[model samples]
Target: MSDKPNDLQKIRSVADYQFGKGVGEKLFPGGVKIVHSKRTGRIRHVYLEEKRLATLRPTNGLFSLNIAGAKRIMKHVKPQRLWVRVREEAEPFVARGKSVFAKHVIDADEEIRPQEEVTVTNEKGKVLAVGRAMLSGKEMKAFKRGVAVRVRRGVAEEVKKETLTLV
Candidate 1:
């Protein structure tokens, strides 16, 4: 909203808890804008000038990270939380927005819990998709018959952001 300082701090705290330390400051850097709901006066979205970064869920006080936000966070943070590494063979398919399966997951953050948001990446750590984890990291690596991450956005679609405007 108009008063970005307080809002930024709150969001930063959430990001740091959900992702990892320093990720909050990286995601919502200086000069970024926070959009709030007029009716609720709660943060609804965030942007960096023309690019949409994330959506803030007031109910849960959690952020639903967009592809751009994921990329930004991944770039700056190491040993990132909520990330799953898929094998090379699954790279193209994951980049196309397909769900990641347990068989294809090479590694994952051991702290990842089911139903949490996660970023799917290749072995090289390049982000392929942003999604929700359907299984825990332990299960993803230990099992071979279930979906791991339910992808919400893919790398290919991120390229289309330039053609679209944040609303």
Candidate 2:
């Protein structure tokens, strides 16, 4: 509790490990608050002002990225990794939090593994959702009928909610 710097370092290291090199510093900049669990005293959530960036999962010790976190990766990380690009026909459905079918996939990072965190994007590389990969990236490209990514949060849902708030 006394060492905010240490906590930040720890989370940054985790992010780098889970995502890619140098991602920790880019994703989590200075002045971010790291929230710890009350029961276990481990890193739980990371935030900047009011918006959450990521949640450190206790089960896997990896990150479950929020929309902001996903965008950060897309924006800051070059040669984007862990992303599944879907066809235009499925964009609206996928953007609304629907699971991605392998048939709809146009491309994907071949490095992606099953159950790993991934970003679902449009052909133009706009991130539409964040999700857990149900299939390996190779499998996603080869197959045509099964689910590829189980979307956890969709940009459309978030945009709709935010739009309501603004109205």
Candidate 3:
């Protein structure tokens, strides 16, 4: 017979490996039932009955609510900020050795507000620069013109410019 504590530890390890550290605790704090099948490697889906899902929902079935609306509904609950780590690089471009703009948009926190200070990082999570956001999360999603972030500090890489032609 196998020990219950040993079995629990093995399960926790597998959950952490699959979803990342603290994910298991966030998703299933009480505990979860794991089903292993030959068709699916190790574990398939994590199941939370409808009751559990309902408890997580805010009004009717909405997970997203504005700050004021959320406060009114869940007075006891505090708003939590979620950060997503992204892998990409953004470098500021200069024209005639004068800082002009950024070459690319690195990983973005979709919840970032305009004029907020944000940390810009490369694909390896290395801090490249810090700057103020010029656009909102939605605007950044479809931005095609104007400066997105005005870098204030850190290394800036130069980009090769193509010769312009007048028609």
User: What are the Cα lDDT values of the candidates?
Assistant: 0.87, 0.94, 0.38
How do the residues 1-167 of candidate 2 rate in per-residue lDDT, one tens digit apiece?
56556888999999999999999999999989989999999999999876789999999899999898999999999988999999999999988999999999999999999999999999999999999999999999999899999999999988898889899
Off by over 4 Å in 3: 1-103, 156-167
lDDT of 1 by residue, 1-167 (tens): 57556987988888888887888899999878989999988889999876778898777888888888988888887767788999999898888788998999999999999989898989998889899999999999999988999998888777766547453
Clashing pairs in 1: none
The alpha-carbon deviation from the true structure for residue 14 of candidate 3, after best TM-score superposition, in angstroms, is: 38
Q: What is the lDDT of residue 9 in candidate 3?
A: 53
TM-score quality measure for candidate 2: 0.92
In candidate 3, where is summed lDDT lowest over 10 consecutive residues?
50-59
Instruction: Give the true-structure RMSD of model 2.
Output: 2.3
Cα deviation in Å at residue 153, candidate 2?
Answer: 0.3
True lDDT of residue 63, candidate 2: 98
Residue 32 displacement (Å), model 1:
1.1
Return whichever of 1 and 3 wins on TM-score.
Answer: 1
